[model samples]
Target: MELLNDMALFVEVVKAKGFRGASEATGVPNSTLSRRISALEKAIGLRLLHRTTRKVELTEAGQIYFERCKRIVDEARLAHEQLGEMLAQPSGVLRVSLPVDFAVIYMAPLIAEFAERYPGIGFDFDLTPRHVDLVSEPYDIAIRMGEPESSHLIARPLASLVPRLYAAPRYLERSGEPKEPADLEQHECLNILKANTWTLHKASASIQVSTSSRFTINSVGLIRRLATLGMGIMLVPEAIVMDDLAAGRLLRVLDHWHGKPTPVYALTETRLLPAKTQRFIEFLKERLG
Candidate 1:
């Protein structure tokens, strides 16, 4: 049991890169983590890490050992979590990475409801647009707007958001309404990232329109705001602009054509997840399906 604890500590220290970082992550003193790693090295009869002032590098032996130890630690953790699931209430810190605008505008109410249902579960949310590494990061789940790039991670579909073209009344008054997809080429489009082209579907037909933009921003909220301010027309998910449309701030264009649906996924490092994480994903699917 003592050896297993030491091995887990060693793994945490290696994952964190340095004793100070490990201390901050695990809430253990740096001196204690250092001593435990030293003890682990002595017991294994090998130098596990090359320590310098700036960073700690794993020795060849340490790299090999970490590969084996990580699996054991993960299995042990999974075992404990599986047992914990048998209880009436699941309990743990549920760390999640979420897209900032989406979470605030769409998921906040659902999250609040989930919290009320599972009071035993605590949350730590990172609402950033940056992609988080599921294997290396401490996050239990990540709610992403599109398909995950990494094949190693497991992803479950939560919802598909139908997108459409929208513009403020003021902008349409100035630029005139687009009668066809080709008309978009003549208008100033507010683009998100590199999505300068939009595919619109009507009945059995689809048209791809190429557009140019003077303003290209990464944030969906900002793009919606810019559209409301009559900066230009925007192609965005209908749910994102629902409030603006209700308040007469923006109007949907091309009633006969709608943009392609954007999928939202809940990503995890492994398919075998804790009860807390599994429940959260299930809850999202239930609500969003």
Candidate 2:
């Protein structure tokens, strides 16, 4: 048990790249963390890390040992969490990174329900556009739209949101309604940055409609607001504009045609997840899938 504890400490030191950082992350004293790692090296009869004043680098033996120990520690932690779930409700601070617009517009109600279901759990939600570093950061998971760019992270698909063309009624009244996919070329479209084309699909046919806009947006919330304010037409998921549709702020265009389905994923650093994160992902899949 002591050996396992030491190995876990070693893994944290390597991940954090220094004793001070590992101490901050694990809430262990720097002296204690250093002592533990030294004891671990002595026990294993190998020097795992080359320590310097500025930082620590893993020795060849340390790198190999870290790879093996990380998996073992993760598995052990997972086993404990699984057992804890069988005995009681999974309880902990679940830190999650979410897309800003989706969390407010779509996931709010679902999150409320989840909170009610798991009274033992607390949450720290980070809603931002930045792609968080799941490997180095302490975030438990990140919910992202579209496919994750990094292949190193594990991505679990939660849902696919179908996008369709929509515009404020006032904008449609002035610009006139588009008759077909090609007609979109004539209208002012509100688009995300670098988005030049929108492909619309019917039962058997599809066409890529070239789009141009006066305003370029990077934020989904801002884009939705602009569409509601009658700036221009937008290709977005219905869930994003549900309130606008309900209030007659926005109306669907090209009723027969739809854009490509956008995928939502829960990104994590590893496949082995704690119960708190695992259950949260499962709940999302149940409601959103």
Candidate 3:
């Protein structure tokens, strides 16, 4: 529709921040772009944008309308891509968020393979330890660890991670071995955070150890380094410290003990996952299995 086209043009103009830029992006002349936006303002009967020689600025109505129109334009673009890709190739910018450690350990290889398979598709990935919102954020997909407390979004299980206790072999030699969880109290236990208590499980019996730490850090990488340096015993994920355990830099404590395990999920805003998202999720799921 003409109105839809005008709406789309207006959004582009605002986002691109200049009539000339929007015109170039949409392959329309700057004069035509300006006229279309004017027409849109007339039809809507609202001043959408404040014209400035330097930069375009959106009014309050413009901001509200822009959000709605942008989503519609995005969906329209996606619809066209879906149909075109049926015969051609999948091509779009995929915005993704992932947990830092998991991406470094697991997602790197998979993402590499995905790039090889879909050369047309571009990825914008954010790797942070913090959880990201699927609804409000622009991200198309997020790979998260553990069950999300937020019940609004759709999530598919990608993998499982179990807590693992490991310490440098030298630490055990100098500090003496802790045969039971209670004995950990006698040793300088490394805490990921200075405030939180550590929970360890042996057989079916769970032990809670209050930490006495010589060093404390929030970064998991730093914690692992301290553990490898024989500073103290550390508790982390099996997936995270598998190499250390194998290389004998760190050895597992209470091999028969059970630690809390968490499930990783591929989260999205919609149940109707995009093809790129679906494929990436499948790839991670397969790799995890």
Candidate 4:
């Protein structure tokens, strides 16, 4: 037998007082258990038990060895229980990263619902505009916009946030409604400063148009703010403008032209996911739909 197994058996036999009792406790046969204990004594060069009677008594060495072996057995039992508990419920902190704009508008409801469902799991969220490193960073999950390039990390599509041209209702009254994508040239356009180009999709064919706007902003929230103020028409995700639309603050312009869906991704370290991550992703996907 392995040394650890022998040590464990020795401890059990000493505690139970004899091979017969230890065999019954550990389910090891009496003869094999006796031989194993003898082999352990020979290896250790110590008399562990004084036997050949109704019961057995521990030697000095047996008492010392039993103390150490009990600790090892206790540790093994604890490790087994910990693994089983991990399989049953989500535990520990689940750190996540997301864009500030997306988190505020779309993810807020999803997170509230998620927290209610998995009350045992804790969350740590970092909301920022810049991209975060998944491999080096401490976060377990990331919500990213636009198409993800090929990488080892797993990316699950939560939603395709299709953009539509929009402006404030008050702005439309001042600047007049845009009839087509080209009509945007006449209105003040709030541009998100990525590259200069914007793609406008029609019923049949899509057009890649280069735009020049007076208000060029890096922050999506700032751009939305500019549109809400009636400065210009902007192409933004419906999630961001849904409240404004419902409140009669923002109005959709050029209903015929829609921007292509900017894919939203729930990225993680691996596709073979744990229960907590899998459940959160599924929840977000369902909520988005």
Candidate 5:
């Protein structure tokens, strides 16, 4: 419909932050885009944008309208793309957010294989520690290590990583190896932020140890590196330290007991995803599961 077209244009303008940017993105002349938006305002009998010579800002009503219009436009676009997918391989920009360490250590090979299989799909990957807003951001999916906090986003389980405790051979020689979980209190522990405690499980027995670390970090890569440098013992996913373990850079302690398995998820804003996103999630589940 004409109204739906105008709503899609409005959403683009809001996302681009101005008519000129939207014009560049949509390949429409700035004058025509401006005129259509003005006509839309008149039809709705409400101002949507506050425009100046330099920039355009959304009014309160415009913000609400943009949110609703974005979803509708997205659904329409997805429907159109799904029809195309039935005839050929799904093709589109597949934007994903991933944790840096996990992507490099565990997923890089799998992603490369997937890319090879789907040459039509382009990738825009964001490797950062920050939790991205699935609603506000343009990411198609986010591969996260733990469970997502928001209930609004749809989560698909990809894998469960078994975590284990490890220390550099030199560090174990110097500080002595911990025979049990409680013995960790006497050794230097390297921990991720907000993870000062570790719960190790063995059959029916579980031990909770409050770990102390001189250097608390946010990066799993950094923690692994520090553990290799003999700074302290680390509890991390076994997949992350496979190379180190094989090379004798790190030695596993408490081999009979292991930390809780951390679940990995692919998060999306809505369940009704485009074919590109849906296929990508399915591919990950098939390969990683």
Candidate 6:
């Protein structure tokens, strides 16, 4: 690597026609350029330059070396410029995995904003509940709610969303509203999967209330929709239910009590991320952090 660097410096010095000129062009000091070129010639066991008081000229060996080194330097410079272009305006298909309900209910608008911001990037999104194999799959990244199951994958925390109780006005009117955390047991609670216990916090105090419901759902979108239709009360993030709240479909049940915060993570097979993936994660952190 050092030899290649010295070769590039030599090429620069030759192009400038003198050490002083090369120093001005490359931001390297004239003394440093002179020392490096001298070291380079010594390492190659050839006198590369015939230096006079006012100017420098290439030797017969230096002439041939310049031709070869010039091409190498030009190619290396092109590669660096191309990489800089990619960093500035990344262009490619960004394939990603996302949680279905969260993507639809929460990330839809954020994705639209991102798409508008990065016009050069194309998207390939997979919104599903099944775990994606990042190591074997062609995915750039995966956005998941709650904790990541695998320790092998790299997880970057985007946000932690605290869930609150929500229910349609009709359901609340019919079954009556709970004033305390213990009162949740008497009401019909809509659960995600088989989770029957709802742990809620108030100030510094906390309580775990046993819940019962006929509907056991895997999808948050479905559970939210069910809650809106007066099926039962749901514990979910405000961002997921914002539209429903605005439309008066659901209202906060226990105003002061909040469930545990669910962590949102961006999972990757490795920490070395491409420009597209890195930008997407940064955008999410800015908006949802």
Lowest lDDT 10-residue stretch of candidate 2: 82-91
lDDT by residue (122-234, candidate 2, tens digit) is 99999998999998888999999986686789999999999998999999999899998999999988888979999899999999989998887887788889889888899
TM-scores, in order shown? 0.68, 0.69, 0.65, 0.70, 0.68, 0.83
- Model 1 clash pairs are none
Task: Please name the candidate that would achieve the greatest TM-score relative to the true structure.
Answer: 6
Tens digit of lDDT per residue, candidate 1, span 29-141? 98998899999999989999999998899999999999999999999999989776565365799999999999988789899999999988999999999989888989999
TM-score of 5: 0.68
Q: Residues 196-240, candidate 3, lDDT per residue (tens digit)?
A: 567777667787877688775777777888899998887777877
In the range 1-289, model 4's lDDT, one tens digit per residue, is 3888888888888888888899999999988988998998898899888887687788898888889888998888798899977876776678899999889876898899999999988999999867778889988899899999798888999888889988998889988987767766666778888545668998888887666677658888888888888888888888988888998888888887889889998989877666777788888888886
lDDT winner between candidates 3 and 5 = 5
What overall lDDT goes with each candidate model? 0.90, 0.91, 0.82, 0.84, 0.90, 0.91
Please list the residue runs of candidate 6 whose C-alpha ends up more than 4 Å from where it truly belongs after superposition: 1-4, 11-46, 50-75
Clashing pairs in 2: none
lDDT value, residue 231 of candidate 5: 94
lDDT of 2 at 143: 98
User: Better model by lDDT, 5 or 6?
Assistant: 6
The superposed Cα distance between candidate 5 and the true structure at residue 207, in angstroms, equals: 0.9
lDDT of 5: 0.90
